[model samples]
Target: MRKKKCTMSIPTIIECFQMGMTSNEIALQANVTARYINSVLQQHNVERQPHSSWLRRYTVNENYFKTWSASMAYVLGFFAADGCLPKDLQLVSFSQKDPKILEDIREELQSTHPIKTNPRTGVHLLNISSKIMKEDLMKLHGMSPKKSTILEFPYVPEEYLSHFVRGFFDGDGNINYKKRTVSFVGGSQTFMEHLKKRLERYSFEPFIVSKEKYHRLFLSGRKTVYHFGQWIYKDKNLYIERKHLEFNREKLPPDQIKDRPFKAHKSAIEARKLKLLYYYNLYRDFPEACKSANIGINTFYRWISTDEEFQLKFNSICNEKKI
Candidate 1:
């Protein structure tokens, strides 16, 4: 009597592989031995990809991208600042002038990939080829391979939004006390617009200005910069110290901060509305605007609820001016 052959389909095996299942695991699910599963996969011309040494050395945690985590926020910020996704390849890369930054990012990600340095360019790069990560980033954050002009604002977790923003600011933002500006520069117009909208939520009046090929999100005025610096630097653990140090009030000239024309009223109801308008035009965040205007949180809420004209003006300004 002739014995029947194992009946698992090639498509099933491929699906299991795509899901990051090992051959043995796929075999268990299919009620077959591991060898049979590998044979089936091989017969279908699906060669198992070789794992990188870095990947082999470390236990890859796929759960990191399942939600908005502190590590994830930091990675996104680093990506926005100095990382690149090659459209033609499966690799995601981070390049930095400081190798330590790359090392910190690698540690934060728990990535096992070895850092590569280009002597000519004087930049250290950490490259990773991770399909699961790519999919997660694309699905969760809409990050595509050729993500330049197409980059959009991520749906960040509310509690960790500041962390993610800090990562990006650390990567690409600059604090110029002399110029009285804290700015972020990027090549994507879409990214710039999204950043402007996000800043509005924080009451930050970020101005978008085009310079050469890239766009700049600029928060000017000492009060505005000080408030922004405070918000972003609230937790220094996740930032580049050199960049964070520039925002230290004591380190900067007190005369410059004092001479600034921003005056706050004690009641801060009407003042909040005026500041909101100022920030709205600049496309800044609401909370930061409140802080900058010295409006108490409770007062801001009461004014918003009781003041009808204030509401109308706020909406009107946002509709007419915000980009």
Candidate 2:
């Protein structure tokens, strides 16, 4: 049988991706299935940007009040990082590959909304479509529907700011033990700058790096990384365990570190580069190689493009294999 043709043009899909439309939304607008939209997006290697909440539809929840609480702050922080309140859709959604994180979010919100998983991509999406909850988030948290570039710090109580930041960090932060860097990546310049100021208020030094379309706030050096980790995890049992464990590895005793399989930094980030090189040689096991090397697959590919030595070594290995 002849293969079915794609109805939507590649350019249109790219345009929608640039507009921060989710694959499903793009599919809906373009008269295609979500899977088809995703396939085309993958072909173009388009990065999936977060959705803006500007056009979200909702009924007012008169009972909602602007109260400060740890749970509310955490939910706001997590939403600021990875969630979306699509205007016309009348829904607030958070999607992550990890189901555990979604479960944590569900429990935090104390909501009955069902968690839906996309079988093809293994991404779990938590949807909140209730008008009451939508209005509550908007009024209490200063969450605007169109909050991408205009996002600012949420109205978190002073004492619970750390909890909120912790939730945001868990959603969008990255910790590189070898490099001793703690980074938060986002597209909102205002939000990032506010975060820098907030960290400064807490006596934590953070610097921001501007990329083409996004910004990254970096907290470097052992002192800052250690301090931030200790502060954020002080409450214990309220964080992403894997990240907290990795963050505190440096403070572990030698025996304890060994037992926990923690590798101390060798005064160099080159250690990670070398590991990446080793993984690059495992050509047949591409996904597992990237996982083992503790880097994203796209990042591994980018390294091959930018690093001459890495590219040369990979090419040489490929030549030797003659496959």
* Cα displacement (Å) at residue 309, model 2: 15
lDDT tens per residue, model 2, 64-109: 2355567666666878888877664445778777778788777666
Residue 67 displacement (Å), model 2: 3.0
Computed on alpha carbons, the lDDT of every model, listed in order, comes to 0.69, 0.68
> What's the TM-score of each model vs. the native?
0.61, 0.59
Q: Write the per-residue lDDT of candidate 1 for residues 1-323, one digit (tens) a residue.
A: 11134445677667555434677766776677888877777888875775313334544454466777776787787687787765534456788877887788777777777787766788888876676776777787777776766678788877777788888887788888765677788888788888788888987766565545787777766667777887776654566777777877435564455424433432223433655655555545667766665667787677669889777766776676545
lDDT of 2 at 30: 69
* TM-score of model number 1: 0.61
Backbone clash count, each prediction separately = 15, 6
The model with the greatest TM-score is: 1
Alpha-carbon lDDT of model 1: 0.69
Superposed model 2: Cα runs more than 4 Å off: 1-66, 252-323
In model 1, how large is the Cα lDDT of residue 268? 28
